[model samples]
Every structure is written in structure tokens, then in C-alpha cells.
Target: MIAALIALCVFALSGFGLSFWLRQKQDSSQPGEAATRGAEQLSQLRWRDFAKLVLQAMQGRGYRPVIEDGMPADGIPTDGSDILLERGGERALLSCKYGTGSIVSAQSLLGLSKSASLRGAENVIVVTPGKFDDEAERIAVPQHIELIDGSELWPEVRPYVARPQEPTPVPPTAASNIPLMAWGGAAVAGILVWFIVQGLQPDSEATSPALAPPAITAAPPASVPPAAATPATTKPVAPPAATFPSDPAVIEQHRRETANAISTLFGVDRALWSTQSTLMVYLSSEQSDPVNELCPLLERYPELASSRVQLQPPQGSTKAVRFKQCRTY
Candidate 1:
């Protein structure tokens, strides 16, 4: 009976050990299954959420990121560039495509390249949850578009993809402040020296002898009679009047000279011409408008008095500019 109890005890111990090994194997498999599900869920995220993830990843990579909500009305092509990344004056545009099992196409890359060119971006990137086709890769290679697929989107790759943060600039030390303090000390010393010199000056009244009062003397009793007043003289003289030329050639010359002077004063390149007794000024668009500066010119020149003036911008320019006579004068 004791031998039979020992056999039964050994059998029970062996069964318990087998059960423990099975449980350990099942637990180890659970982690792998969970990891696979997590990766699949990440790949199947919503488009907006995926864009948000891209933004977060870019931020972690030391890039200034902004998400564009809708298409911009500007002249740039709209290729669904949802994210803009900026760093050190360089700009990049990113388009995110999520939850799509198909490969990215070459047409998508072409559109992104065109948008980057129109928007003046230095870099273009397409973020996808799936792989890119062979044609897309060939097109992107030449266009300089970067493609990021789901496999590269893993957490371990983030650190490697992220740019290193720029070192913070060091502030000025106490030694740099020494010059300012020295200047202040020198100013104080100069004031003290001035006061000391003032205090050391000798007093004029203390150093000189005292003067005595002069003796009083009487004047003559008789005085000459007051001189007679002379008669007033009067004269009349005429004032000279200023003259101005009325000749059209002379007036046009004067206008050209005045316009040139005004142009030089205001740092504008302008040409003046006369047509049917009216003055026309052609100004290049590269220079600033001299409309306000023309007021003083009109006031000083009589040749342009009561004459119509026209200001024209460069050819092919759409700038609408109007010139009115100087009413202030």
C-alpha cells in the first residue's frame, strides 16, 4: 500500500509540472499577438489621426510643424499637402495617406513634386501606411521626394529619423558686463574730479584788496541849449517784379529739371515728357512711388502750375496709381 501511494504522488507531481509549462508557453505567445495587433491598428488609423501622428513625429525630430486644414486659395498648386515642416529657413511639405492597402502611384508623386515647386518648398515627402510601387519609387528618386512607409514608421526608427536639436546659444557672461561697469565708474570719477577742481579754485574777493570810494565833484552850472531837430526827408522807390517764361519749350525744360530734382531727392528713377501742354511722368515699378514727393515739386515750380499731371507705372504692371494736382499749394 505504501508503494502504491508513492506512484500516485509522482504522477500528480508530473501532471502539475506539465500544466505549468503549457501556461508559460501560452503567456509568451500572448505578447507577440498583442504586438502584431498594435502594428495593424497603427497602420489602419484614420487619415486625420495619421496626420496628427506625423506632426508629432516631426516635432520630436526638431522640426517646426503646421497642419493645413483646407486647400489654400493662393496660386500654388493644391496637392493635399496637409503638413508643413520648417527648419532653419528651409521648408518641406508632407502628404499623408493612411488606411490604404494599395501601393502609392507615380501620379501621386508627380502631383507632390509639382506642388513643391509651386509652393517653393525645398523638400517633399509622402507618408503612407503601405509601400510605394516600383514606378512611384523611380519617379520619386529623380524628383527628390522622400517616401516613408509603414515599416519605417516604427517607434525604434523615430530616434534615428529625427534631427538632432541645435545647441542653445550661450548668454553673455559677467566678464562681458565689465566694460559697462567700467564706463560707469569712469563717468563717476570724472564728476568727482570736476567737483574737487571746483572746490580747489581760489576765491577772487578773498585774494584781492578792498577798493576805496571816489571823491564827489560838482558839474558846470550853465549848459548849452538843446540842438534843433532836423526836417524829415522822404523818398519813393518801386520794387522789382519776378519774371517767368511762357514759352512751351522753356516750360517743358523747367518741368523736366524739376521732375529730375524731385526724383533724385526721393531716390526714384522717373522720366518726364510733355504732351499737349500736359506733363506725363513715367516711373519704374522697381522704385518707390513719388506721389507725395511731387507735392513740394509742384509748389516750387510755376511751369507745372495749373497743368494736368499723369503718373504711369511700368508696362505690364497692374499697379493702379492716380495723380492729382497739389491742392495744398
Candidate 2:
């Protein structure tokens, strides 16, 4: 009887201890809660400015690119440098890093690479606006990784994609003065920076915790690294057939815009163009010709034009975008 009682007592004590251990293990594994909290902190950072710079760089290199907010469990996605590239089966998975302290954390890179491996990704690329440290670079490349920094990113971001521009011949009246259309070209140039390769971060609270000393620019050391050729110069583009509907209301709105643009560029009050539906079919002077004419210019897959189309937001969006509505059309 005593043995039976003792056995029961021991079994009860063991069960309690085991339960306690299991609970402890679960508590330890709930590390995701901390990560979630951290992500919340970082969420305030838009990260877009940094992302834009990165995307433009990659696309400029003639590689198909996609942008996404996060990685997927299935590894099937198309967004943010978390991209999938297909170059004759030279497949790769990419994760982009944006404006942050100079240091590149090994934990972040290693985890990303491991994820890629799980997805059977042939390789990985990590692009950062900020620099990565030496240690991060050392660990990354032998593992079949590619690293791109801000300086390297610039030309790619500005890849001379064939785009349409209204080519205005130098009018005999004033050869030296920069054309108003050229100024329009500059506006489009701004779009290229923010458009092609850019990062958007959320507004995170400034914990103002002084960051550690910045990490040395983190990228694979170029030791007999294949030198990338410089991007070539290209001719300006003429407007391609823009994509939009011919909404009279939209067209008339653009007519007003054409007037404003002319005023800004040519210092003329004359609205030289008229719209049919949503399209702004217009007559342009030489000074503003490059921006106004469109039918496929020299740059590759251009998101902007020298003579451009402006698109407006729906009735209640925050701000108005010039020629944005036209792009959608």
C-alpha cells in the first residue's frame, strides 16, 4: 500500500514539473511578440525614399524587378526588391534594405538567405541605400549573394529606359535659352528618381536612441569582381501613345494644365493644346516640343515624358498629381 501511495505522489510531482517546463519552453519561443513590437516601432518609417532609389537601380540594369512589403510563406510574390528574377533560369530572390544606420546586421542577412534557400532560390541579392559593414559583406558573397550600395545604385536607378519625349528643334529665334519643355523634362526627371528606384518608410516614433557607430559601407569587396560597364547615354524620347480614356471632363482639366505648363515653360498664356476625351492632343512650339510630342522616345519603358500627361486623384485624395491621370488613361 505504501509503495502504491509513493508511486502516485511521484507521478503527480513529475507531471507538474513537466507542465511547468513545457510552459517555460513556450514562453521562450514566443519571440515573435518581441519582433512584432519592434516592427511596430519601425513601422513609422516610410522607407519609400530608400526603396525608390533601390528599385530604379535594379530595373536600370535590365533585370525584371518587383517590389513587395514583406516576404511570403510560399515564396511566390512580385514586389519591392523582394523580387524574383528569371534570366535563363538564373533565378534569384532579393531582399532590399533601405535608409538605416550604416551597420548591416548578420542576423538579418542570414535569416533572409535561409529563407531564400528554403524557397529553392538559386541566389540572393541584398540592396541597401546605407552601407554594409565588412563582416556582413564577407559572410554574404561566398554564399552566392549580390550587394549594391547607394553610389552603385544611382546609374541603375536612372537606367536610360527608352521613353517618349517631345523633341523640339532649336528654333532660330532663341537657340541659347533653355526651353520651357526642358523644364518639363526636369519635372519628369524628378519622377524618375522618385518613380523608378525609391523607398517608402513609415513614420516611426523617434526613440532617439543614439544609434551605434555607423557600420562601414557593407558590400562584397571587389577583388577581381566583374566590373560592371557604365550605362550608355541615349536620345531623348518622344511621347508614346499614352494610356487613358478620353473623358471630356478629364481632357478639359488637362487643357487648363497645358495652359499652366506653358505659362511656366514658355511664359505664354496661350493654351496651345486641346483635348479629345481624356487625351491632350496639342500643338507645341519648338521650345516646348520635346515635352509635348509623344510617340516613344529614346529611354526604355519610361514612366514619365518630356512633354507629359498629368493625372489627377479621385475626388477626395490628398493631393493632385500632374499628368498622373493621363498615365492611368
Models 1 onward score TM values of 0.34, 0.30
Best by the TM-score measure: 1
TM-score between candidate 2 and the true structure: 0.30
Model 2 CA deviation exceeding 4 Å by range: 1-46, 66-81, 159-329
The whole-model lDDT of each prediction reads: 0.58, 0.46
RMSD of 1: 31.8
Q: Per-residue lDDT for 1-329 in model 1, tens only?
A: 44344444544554455556554664566545544444454575566556666667766766676434563433122443446677777888877766446477754554565456556677787877667887567546545678887656545233433342222333467434544554545455555555655677777876666643455788877764555345556786778543557787887666665555444322244546566445566765636566666655555555465556677677776877556666422
Native-to-model Cα distance after best TM-score fit, residue 36 in candidate 2, in Å: 34
Superposition TM-score, candidate 1 onto the true structure: 0.34
Per-candidate count of clashing residue pairs (backbone under 3 Å): 0, 77
